[model samples]
Target: MSQPNTSPSGRPATLAPLFKASAGDPLLAMMLASGGDERIAAGPDGRNRYGASARPEAGEIWFSSSTASGVSRRGWQAASAALPFAFSAGESEDWFSDLRRRLLNLLAPPGAQAVFCASGTQAEYAALALAGARARPGQKIVNILVGPEETGRGAPLAASGRHFLNSAPFGSGRAGFALDGWEGAAALAALPLRNGAGAPLPADEIDARVCALVRVARARGAHALVHLLDSSKTGLSAISRDCATKLLRDNPDDVTVVVDACQLRCAPAQVRADLDAGFLVMVSGSKFLGGPAFSGALLVPGGFAESLAARDQDIPWPEGLADHFAYFDWPPLLRDRIAGPFGARCNSGLGLRWTAALAELEAYCALDPALIEMAKACFQGEARRQILMTPGLEMDESGGEPTLIPIMMRGAEKGAADAALRKLRRRGLHLGQTVPIGGREALRLCLSAPQIVDFAWRYREIGDQNFAFGPLRADLEKLFTAWGALLG
Candidate 1:
């Protein structure tokens, strides 16, 4: 491995043998294979950065701490340095302008306040609160929630939440929703769950029912629950256009759309189409936005945010603040909607890191596109091909439309998956493994960050007996490639 040539930070360029060397070839295996790497020493880029972690092959690993550490350091500095506009953002309009302009171009929406929050969950809560701000206290606020019905989804419903219209069928009564297959979307819409409940319908046939959900809302004399739909997970692109057509009609004014773009930075362009159709865009920097887990943002559409802002004339909440939404907690910023229009941010170390990471990413993405494609074609693409080995390793559909490409070994014997995992660990390779969709054991090979610049060389280093890379290489090839060798 080469040391950083002219790096003032004294950081080594390649993976260090003692700290990074695996049983395989490369001596300097990065921590978060692609997206994040924590450098023991500094580099020319900065003392903290380790350059986008998470790139790996079938037999390598990616670490998180590396890039996370970098993002944290830089973001903290930038955010802390920000003029702490607790009340007024009279001067920082330019900075916010770049942010706002980019958002408009991507979301393709007109009139939006690109505001930052602490995290995605907070963004969701804030979006809901903003929506619920319209509630006339007993004015039926039907908060429609669609997701796996886990992890803070219930927060909004509890607040002015009268009808939790599950866009899909759910098992657990705790706002249970079972919206997975196309059929499920239809079934839930068929019976409409009767606002409260009645005869539960199955989604087996009426798979396209999700489209008619608006009709259900109208019938129940309720408004759209602002659809807490996170498109990052659900591939809204795959949904039949026939179903979403009416919803997609350009009516940014009539309906209230609050999108949880938790996986924003990594998301493709079409995602903006969804945001453009909404009254609010909730972006979280943690997931794919390349920031700490804490910092998130709420990009509110146009003048609506000011309407929801806490003002002198507006009565304080709990004077109508629902208990369910009491879970939406943030150090309140007393911004008068009328006094000044601006982005009110929380004092968070992670928040600082998020801003810096964004700046870095924005810069990197502004390079030569053809060169970028050529580089990807030569590097990561090849690595991906190599990792999808072994016929039985089935890739599961990631909900968040994950930047991490995940593969699950389906129907493998109880010890089979674990045995494979152990073998990889011995070889100094790690994987993202978990209990798969149907109680199945799975392993995911993600190509997201600190990458091996010389991956091809590492691939060739296998089985050089003088080093450990050789034996481990044989072991892995035997596990999967042995069959290929036999056939060959």
Candidate 2:
């Protein structure tokens, strides 16, 4: 059969033939069936009713971080300069590395090594591969701990034969583990960090359990990769401090820990402290920074860099995935044996995405701490009050001061939650995906800097609940009005 014709811009003439041709590819088939195209319904303003719109919507209220982000005016301005370059550049010109440096300087400490990936999942796969490589040569198993929740859409796709330890409440604890078919790994173990109600386990008990797990894995000669949850869909600061300390402080040999900060919501001080304590941290530009979707970077500190660099072989990434990464962007030491098919330049939109992220970072850095605190208080208070009055929504109070609110939709079936989302979108308000929590359908409304700052600009006259000179009351009223009507 003749291949599909190409458009002038080089895209397939039609997606239908491509979908049919993709019958042998599981991932492609899933994409065609996932309704992703319909899910991002565009509004009259040219933005997805969800965020991630290329253009601005004057009054759109976005509470969706599980999905992509909306472009801010400043972000758009920053990204615009790169469009010509992205569309016309013939060869890669260290654009990704430059972006990596800017992000590291803003988010991490000096001397921290960086690697840019297509998405959080790509960075995570590299981390996992490095973790397995750090194991002793004769060891055939590299067991890992995944906590709070796995929100990176590409994570499972990257795990080939590794064992995962579930640290989320009521999580399966073991994914990708098969005794008979085990190839890249040996065994898996899972421990609940929180109970079914979202309350964490006792600190001492958690510490003891983790220590025991590590010791047992050591005894069995398995390499342990401990994942510390910095923030994910469940909420920020989801890990138990005591448990993380025990795992990081006095751990067994052949163990490595990575702080999953992919949500990009963690503070600079938090990241510094974690890196100072010798843990690998992964962060993304797409989440809190409001950049375009699928941009990620890994901050490799001294010890982890040394370990990963010492390995002479490349991490056995999935077949055909090397093309998606900018291996040259990795720290020079760690780039030792990573072979190519590597791009000559940044991925299609990465340069523009990073530019947008850097623009947001600049604004965020210049904000007064007092203003930030005031905005946080205002949004949290309003969100909590709104949740109480909304009929179908209930808050998941398993974590901190409601940075990312997880809610279960009452009377909504497995996929009925999407209908509620659609209704909200039609009203020009966008919430995140309806995720699965404990066999029930759930959704998240994440607080973002752009949202808060925009509100501050639009409602500059209105005072907050504390009678402070911040947080426009009108914005909250608009959001709550839309929310109540949609869910009520």
Candidate 2 per-residue lDDT over residues 153-234, each given as its tens digit: 4354343343232211111223444212235553444455556655656656755666677788778777776667677566
TM-score of model number 1 = 0.52
Model 1, range 1-488, lDDT digits (tens) per residue?
A: 11112212222325223332233212112211211112212344322322332212244333222112223333333443432321123222334434445544444455555544434544543554455454433333344444332223333333232223222111111233321211111112112211122112333222244435555654555444344344423222122223333453532323355555554533334455554544466665444434443345666644555455543343223211121121112212322322221122223233233445464345334444443333334333333444466555555554423334444555566656556655554444444333333445545443222121122223336722224233333433443453223223
Each prediction's TM-score against the native? 0.52, 0.76
lDDT of 1: 0.37
Report the number of the highest-lDDT candidate: 2
Lowest summed lDDT window (length 10), candidate 2: 28-37
C-alpha displacement of 86 in model 2, angstroms?
Answer: 2.7
Clashing pairs in 2: 52-69, 52-70, 92-344, 92-345
lDDT of model 1, residue 169:
12
